[model samples]
Target: MPVRKLLLGVLTLCYPVAIYFGLQHWSPRVMALALVALALLRALTSRQAGWRLLAVAAAVLAAIVAASNHALPLKLYPVLVNAAMLGLFGWSLRHPPSLVERLARLREPDLPPSGVAYTRRVTQAWCVFFVCNGTVAALTAVLASDRIWALYNGGIAYGLIGAMFAGEWLVRQRVMARGRHG
Candidate 1:
């Protein structure tokens, strides 16, 4: 499991540059095949049934399209993923125990009212971030060059996410400290 996590981390870090150059140097068909294989392996190994099923279905659909010799726009992958994340987070907002609250509960099962409010706000922030990220991804796919698309999707997006995570942690720490004192 550690090895898998390490590999995924490395792959994610390298994905943008790799895909950008990959599209330039290799045929789309080859890239599509490789991506499908990786997706299938991930799906087969996934612990969640829903994710496994979704991944399998997506892989099968991509495979069928590949077999038919249609060039699956490589740019669409990240766009679709961002859009899905937006939907997931947005959907969670409408349901009780929003996504951030669930994650917060994992750390503090008996979360305070203040903590619950904080998590809900954080969840809403994340939902907004997803929507903007997905919009950028879609625009890049439609209007930008391949290199530009890859750079934004790969490097810029990850950088923004890391910054957001760090910012949230800092805020949460301050909130918790204030709550304890009060």
Candidate 2:
């Protein structure tokens, strides 16, 4: 990956933890300003429309945080991320060439029709996952304490995502092996 994207990805992954500790040391306005700066950095580095929109959303959220001086706005970044993922994956389902298929094609460029269908189903699964994850993220952001929010958004959420990826890898291995035999 490009350094900019890698850096942004790392920063994004660290966001919840940053918010958790930042709250103890920084004012909400400062936190909000940091979010706005991150958003601007993302916008500058990425040209994809979805990413640009995400940047705008982040900026809006930052504005809210700045105005309200509240931690909840800071906490909603994960929810926003999930919503964006859901939108991307769900839209690909309605359109042709599902996102997972596009990605799978990077390695299996000549993927068979069954592989195509399988990727579509995987994309659908991701949409479902995004919806459920986003819902939980929203709930944690609003109804839970900061520690709970941080724990879920920062740690537990990534663990669940890792589980999904590992499960998918196992299933994909079976499918690929079966394709060779059958």
Candidate 3:
């Protein structure tokens, strides 16, 4: 990957961890401004219009809320990220190619008919996962303590996503093998 892309990917991956630990001393306004700057810079550089625009808007909203009430934005960051992901996935489902289908096309341009169906189903699964995960994060923010919220959204959430990716890869391998044999 290009250095810029790699840096962005690393930053995105480390977001929850940074938020979880940084909240102890950093003001949410500062973090939110940083996020807004990054998001706007990314949007300016992005070739795609859809997600980059949404990300910019979300970041601006985060900054606005953070400026007014630091605690609120800190609590809502995970929820907003997951909710945005859910929206992106759900919206893709309504269009010609779901997100998974588009991604599958990247690797398997002429994916089999069954593979197409599998990708669609996988996309749906991800949509559901995001919805449920976002709900849990929201609840944790509202009903539980900050530490509990951080633990769930920052640590448990990533673990669940990793497990999901591993499980999906295993299943996809089995299915593709079966298709080859049958």
TM-score of each: 0.85, 0.96, 0.84
lDDT of model 1 at residue 28?
66
Off by over 4 Å in 2: none
Give the range of the ten consecutive residues with the poorest summed lDDT in model 3. Answer: 69-78
All models: lDDT? Answer: 0.75, 0.92, 0.79
Cα lDDT, model 3, residue 1: 67
Q: Report the CA-based lDDT of candidate 1 relative to the real structure.
A: 0.75
User: Candidates 1 and 2: which is better by lDDT?
Assistant: 2
The local lDDT score (0 to 100) that residue 166 gets in candidate 2 is: 96
Sort by TM-score, top down from the best: 2, 1, 3
- Where model 1 places Cα greater than 4 Å from the true spot, the runs are 57-72
The superposed Cα distance between candidate 3 and the true structure at residue 59, in angstroms, equals 3.1
Candidate 1 has what TM-score?
0.85
lDDT of 3 at 172: 93
Query: Candidate 2 vs candidate 3: which has greater lDDT?
Result: 2
